[model samples]
Target: MGAHGAPRGRAARPAGEDSRGAAPAGRDGYFDLLRAVALVRVVAYHTFGWAWAGLVFPSMGVMFGLAGTLMARSLRRPALTVIRGRLRRLLPPFWLWGFFVVTAMLLHGWMPDWRIVYWIVPLGDPPGSAWAGQAWEIVWYLRTYLWFVLLSPALLRLFRRAPLPVLALSLVPVAVLTSVPPPEGRFGGALTDLATFLFCWLLGFAHHDGVLGRLRPLAVVLPSLAALALGGWYALTHQARYGGTYDLDDNPLGQAFWSAGFVTLLMYAKEYAGAVGPVRSRLVTVFNARAVTVYLWHELALILAVPLTDRFWEVPAFERYLPLESQWFLFGVGWVLIAGFVLACGWVEDVAARRKPALLPGGRAARMGT
Candidate 1:
């Protein structure tokens, strides 16, 4: 069933229902609102742009935490079983969306045929790399998610045992790796350094075991706040220092702080912020119901919107628009059209879910890290 307690259709229910007769692990309106907020941030940050790109980490941390909550819940079953079920639900929409992105790019002459392979393998240049322009930029998250899913079993087991120590240790790599400058001629400069996501995901797993509640509120709250404040400051300063552009991997301090804030927020959401109602409740019901579809098609909408904005609206090339200073009206209008296109393709995800290939009893991908 979905968050509203309705059974989802093929286009809808890939996330599966919680045993509590609602969305898996049941619904948390705060999280739904958070997801909505995060999606909006992504839209704004990408469309209109923001100087403090560090702010994006908070949303990412929350999203990763959400993924962990879902992952922890699935741990009741054998790791392989959980893996198979998740892949069955996840991969089809990804494959569909990828095909759609490639088709749109080709139709629009965005690139040549050989370029489509990068999207398929999900191994293109990072956002700043030469080949980065050739790949579907927004879809990079999917590549990371696929890696996370592939590694879920080991990650889940580690969290299940020695949860706190595990979470603590995971952060060491994030600090070390994220702080280092990206190597030349590489696209995945930040992938290794951002270990906080793994830590946050594991923290969610432990929360399922009541680990967070055992700690005092101040213990969690103060550190998270400090992280956010300090990180935000660093981000702003760094932008000013670098003439206003932040390399994705440049803000380890901010990412660390944001991840901490995410954990604090999740704790609050689980305890005091239960069951928000009416408008949020309904919006969650709709979005969670169709999340897979929406995610799959969102990039296609972006790609299609690019041409229309250029051809009809006479907007400048996407990269030329200054994010921090762009007029909200022009950006908002383009986003509205893009959002509509995404909504229209929502049904296609349902079709893909129903037609996914079957997995063997235990065989899933052999640890293909994103």
Candidate 2:
């Protein structure tokens, strides 16, 4: 699955539906909307480098929670089958994106070694040319997500045996890391990310198992609000330690608690149980379908946008008429390029999903062969 995109499968019926008269199994529009918003927030955060954006949405945690819910749903089948299906959906789009990135790095005089193989599986942070910039940072999310998927079978079993206790215990690793000096380098970074989001991931299991739904309204709301408060308080007071900002990304414990609280409430509500209306449904479908492509290519698009926008300054008419220097203009250009990549490369997701390829998903043309 993409960092911000969950694996898609038929969701379990919502809480109130009677099985006999239940509507057919279908997409959860609420979950789909969360993902679409996460992807958009990711692109916007990367483009604008906004600190408060993390507070506003906390995209990574939400994505992990959603992925965990879907992963639990899929584990109804054989474990090996579920894992294989996930890898199949995830890797092809990555390989296609890697082809261009790795080739670019090599052309820029990047020396290859055994570490280059990480690009193939990305079990670790993949090496890239410095010239490639922060584009490669997105791989951390993929690496973390892959770890979650692989461990989920065992995690789910343990979660089911004792839902509340295991869910509470999930916070231990992050708590320990936050108290002590974290380890240095790639392993530490990966461990921090895994630990940080582990709570949210298990919260997904809680949501799936009806644990949250079974709880009283106050039980769910009070602790969640308290968490949100503590996380906000910590971030506010501890800003100077983290580059003089309260960006959740800089504070693992804050992010973990905040995201856990925020995502839990969203998942619990199960709002918009049916389709999120017509036009929004189509947009959600496109976002979920091409999620991998959007995430992998978005940074590169933003990188390319800078030079492309710079070129516009040379044309007097464009420089005067356009907000050429504004980050908003760059954001717009980035999405335009993202749309181009989706048309050019997004079909790999369809192929991976065993659906007929389409330039854009959820359209009449894509519907033709299905």
Candidate 3:
């Protein structure tokens, strides 16, 4: 659903420790793996438009949770320093991506107004040509993320003061919003999204602070399952009201509770941090490194893949060999483009992090080591 910023310095403490009784000292692969999977699911859901995908893996909530955990870790330093660092890491990649998108929109006859500044800071939804609307719609995630980063210092303090009660109360906003008639404009939409995922974001805070670690397994599991069931039940019962689909994105109250329960279990099981093997670790690294590039360009890739796939039909040999009409083929082609974007644009992330740019993250180091 969105790209997550990685935390620098030490990882969060796991629920359990090894014989040495120390936490992992570098990037947390379990969190990385969750983020990578969430990114993939976002691409897949967009390409396939599957409603049940939200239930299976609430990608947006998962991403916000990962970002929240990392934000909490980074906030151990001065709040201003952490926030500036996050924005520095986040914005350049966005600006670079926006350059092309905005240029294309302008070429397509989009007349700009004062609101075009949203393309820079994205505190609100940025405008785009209707033809490329899908690409711009994803900016809402970044907008929400920016707001979270800016607000985390205060949110973290509140959570630390009363972790359980604050966590429980985080769901109230979405419930209240959903109980009323849905809001009508961009601000309303943003509010709904923020309230829907605020609990998961706080769950990340809870994870980083080791709040969930102190809970009894049953205490965590029972409530989480109950919430999950309630979310599913609400979606099922309210389908007709929400375009006759069970997609969690269509139901804020359902998404809030569903993602809360789902992400809570994930953060609660931090022991699996060590379960990731070497090959998977490298893959996770790349995903985390290029998350912004991949996320920003993925919709464009999917959109372009359609026309490209249609072109393949003109070549008899290509038509014979490729399943050009299948959605799977489009999915595969979309990833191929995503990989290309990662290779082309991912180095911006390295530069933003103040590291040397490489085709792949750590490519230079790996070569030097060899």
lDDT of 3 by residue, 106-224 (tens): 89889878878999988888877788798888999999999898899999999888889999999999988988856699889888888998999898888776676556567788999
Off by over 4 Å in 1: 1-25, 53-57, 104-118, 121-135, 179-190, 193-196, 240-243, 246-253, 272-280, 292-326, 352-370
- Candidate 2: C-alpha RMSD to true structure equals 6.0
- lDDT (tens digit, per residue) of candidate 1 on 1-54: 235322223122233222223333335555566666666665555554564543
How well does candidate 1 match the true structure in TM-score terms?
A: 0.70
lDDT (C-alpha) at residue 156 in model 1: 73
Q: Which ten residues in a row have the lowest lDDT in candidate 1?
A: 361-370
Clash totals for all candidate models: 5, 0, 0
Tell me each candidate's TM-score: 0.70, 0.90, 0.90
Model 2 per-residue lDDT tens digits across residues 105-197: 889899877878888988898988788867887899999999999999999999988888999888789889988867899899999999999
